[model samples]
Target: MEKETTRIEAFSDGVFAIAITLLVLELHVPLIEETGGGNSLLKKLVAQWPSFLAFCLSFFSIFIMWVNHHKIFKQIYRRNTPLMFANGLILFLATCVSYPTALLSSYYHTASAHVAVAIYTALFVCINLAFNLLWWIASQDRQLLRPEITDEGIKRIKRNYLYGIPVHTLAFILSFVAPTAALFLCVALWIYWAYTSGKLDLKSK
Candidate 1:
């Protein structure tokens, strides 16, 4: 079981690395004025707010997903077929998130921006769903969880995941009317996770 889990971890890590690389491909050189020198080029690039915003959003979103995946596997000492599929599903959803995030950033002021946000939120929802499924499947047989894990720890993790998905999804939904405000809320939640997960009490063995 350990060997199988290790293989899954390795394969997933490779996929994640590839996904992160692909996300950056969306950023490109902004068109600069022909006569205006270095200052013009810099100003043009800075004016391309969409590219920077998309890059930041996608990078952080993927990073957080990777962190959560690491946390889940840390708690699971073994693996089974269901866990394998669940991990695959999570990766699949994660790969889809970048495109929508980029799309939303590009079309942020347009009428179709809402659709992009919806797609982005939906992909994250799918990711969280797969996460929950993997946790339940692995815990059902006790084949994946560490033997010493407490029930309360399991409950806390589940609660954290459950609470997070809705907040994230709703933030995306609300981007239609108040995109800047929604984006700020999303950033706040990301900060919360970063700080909370770093706590000694939240660390898993």
Candidate 2:
């Protein structure tokens, strides 16, 4: 237990860092030839808005997850095979976020925008599901959590996961008919998660 949780956290941090870093690959400046000339530089830069927007959205999503991951570690003090595997599920989906970000940037203005947004929302659906599983497994036994975490703290965490799934699923459903709305919901969900997770800090309870 001494080095167990610490090692898991360190490894999880690395995965999150890599995923966040990969998101930047989807963003690039307009090349000299592509800009046509210095006079047209602003126009070309403006055209890359989709990439810029998607990068920010994806960056913040991963950043918030990283923050909440730290918050979760503050409660979890033990590790088991199931818990580690559940956490790994989260890391896997997080690493894959860059792919959908790339998809959205490439297809945001095309007829395929709905498909791209659906894929992005779908990834989020899986992410929220993985989080729920991780929390559920860790909270099932006090042996896995810190001495300070109470039953209410566990409930709060569970409540957060419960809210996450249906909302993300709704966004996923909306993607087919309203990609822009679905995209907007993703932004809102991150903000909601940040707020809820901040208040649900288990160590404090």
Q: Judged by lDDT, which candidate is best?
A: 2
lDDT of 1 by residue, 59-175 (tens): 887887777777777777787777788889988877776788678667865777666666666666677678788777876876567766777777777776776678777876787
**Model 2 lDDT vs. the true structure?**
0.89
lDDT, candidate 2, 22-67, per-residue tens: 9998888888878788669999878888899899999999999998
Candidate 2 residues lying further than 4 Å off, grouped into runs, are 1-3, 203-205
For model 2 the TM-score comes to: 0.95
| TM-score of each model, paired residue for residue | 0.86, 0.95
Counting only residues 3 or more apart in sequence or on different chains, how many pairs clash (N, Cα, C under 3 Å) in candidate 1?
0
Leading candidate by TM-score: 2
lDDT of 2 at 167: 91
